[model samples]
Target chain A: MSSADLRAISQLDEASRKDIAQWVENEMAQAKLRSTIHNFTEICFRKCVTSIGTQTLAKTEELCLQNCLNRFLDTNSAIVKLIQEQNK
Target chain B: MAFFGKDSEASSTQTQDVKQRVMQEAAQELAVADVTELINNMTKVCYDLCFPNPGPILTSADSKCTEQCSKKFMAAWNIISQTYASRLRQ
Candidate 1:
């Protein structure tokens, strides 16, 4: 990651600095979401689609992709829940 | 008093300038990062789908295959994004 222009940020008033910090946090959140989705697509594509000759995705392939995504998300939440329970 | 007045006015303008610069830079950085990720994934997925039999040149068939592969990859990406967003809300 590029080092943020800290000198410029330091010139802002407290309120303005707070606003900038909030905005940057939101932007980072969105970027994180995008990267996660990209990763999921790569994994699900490998799992769901075995053939590639056709220009269009077969209906079965589409369904497989969706199921792959659903299962992945399910696993994610289940693991998070398990971790929380373990901590408790 | 003179120095304080001048310094406050000058610093306020500088603050405004800096705020705009920081916000613009942040947005630009995020956009570049996102686009780079998309391009990288597209390259990898399309290469895999279209280059199973490697050739020196990309034939018309290979080009078509790559195009379709990219489209399918994008479609999958959208589906995953939607599913993940909904999962997060839950």
Candidate 2:
């Protein structure tokens, strides 16, 4: 590492180092959220929207999009549960 | 000779300054990434939904469809984001 890198790390107190680490962890979680939201939006949009000319979502389409998120989460958990069961 | 160029107190203050700057930079980057992602997704979803066919002229219907498509896409994005966030909390 360069002198600057060494100096930077050395400068941080334990608490400051922990705070920086926590901030980075939080940012990573946020980045994951952004990725998931983008993906889910596309997936649900395709599933829910058929005719796209309406100014407002039809009642059925709105419900489908809402349910899509729940089902997506449910499916994810179910898959994880299945994997855990298989591993055991 | 100490490896650290600065004394303890000075180093702590310097570290705080750096930490603040780093966080601000990260937040700015996150904001930019969010807006870029939104625009890209909006363009893709709206184009597919609104302009299913190619036409030389942009009709009123096409613009209206694109507007609604943008709104619905945003709504879906928010709903999914919230749902994922809630699930993460559990």
Candidate 3:
């Protein structure tokens, strides 16, 4: 990190520092979540689209990608809601 | 007439301006970092996806691999985001 980085970071008070840290942590966690989703799709399509026979993706594999993406999000959201309910 | 709270309001506004500036700067840094990261990751992923194997040294063919990979990765991101957003609303 450079002096500019230290300047920007040092401007924050304790509460502000904590708030910014949490914000960054949350964004990074979400970024990782998204990267994993993308990787999952990339690998799945590669596995299913073997042989290099078709120039375009198969309709079924496309559908599978759609379903896979949603189901993954659905799984996460469902868990989140369940946890929220438990906490209440 | 005398006023005791006027300076407090002035100081509060100055503080508010500082807070706003800090927040804006922070948001901008995060946005820039996110964009650069996305581009870097997309480049790497696209390269691997398009050219799984390479020789000891990359040739002109490998250069095209990187180009095509970026184009397709962007297309995929656009399609996926749009498709998901529409399906999400319904």
Interface DockQ per candidate? 0.41, 0.42, 0.13
Candidate 2's residue-wise lDDT over B1-90, tens digit each? 223345344465677787777677768878888889888988987888777786999998888888888887887777777777777798
i-RMSD values for every candidate model: 6.1, 4.9, 9.1
Best by DockQ: 2
Q: Let me know the DockQ for model 2.
A: 0.42
Per-residue lDDT of model 1, residues A1-88, tens digit only:
2334565465446677678778878988888988888888889988887767776778888888889988987898899999999999
In every candidate, how many clashes are there? 0, 0, 0
Q: List the residue pairs that clash in candidate 1.
A: none
Candidate 2 vs 3: which has more TM-score: 2
Candidate 3 residue lDDT tens string, A49-86? 33233334557645665666677677879999999999
Winner by TM-score: 1
Candidate 1 ranges beyond 4 A from true positions: A1-4, A81-88, B1-13
TM-score of 1: 0.82
- Indicate whether candidate 1 or candidate 2 has the larger TM-score: 1
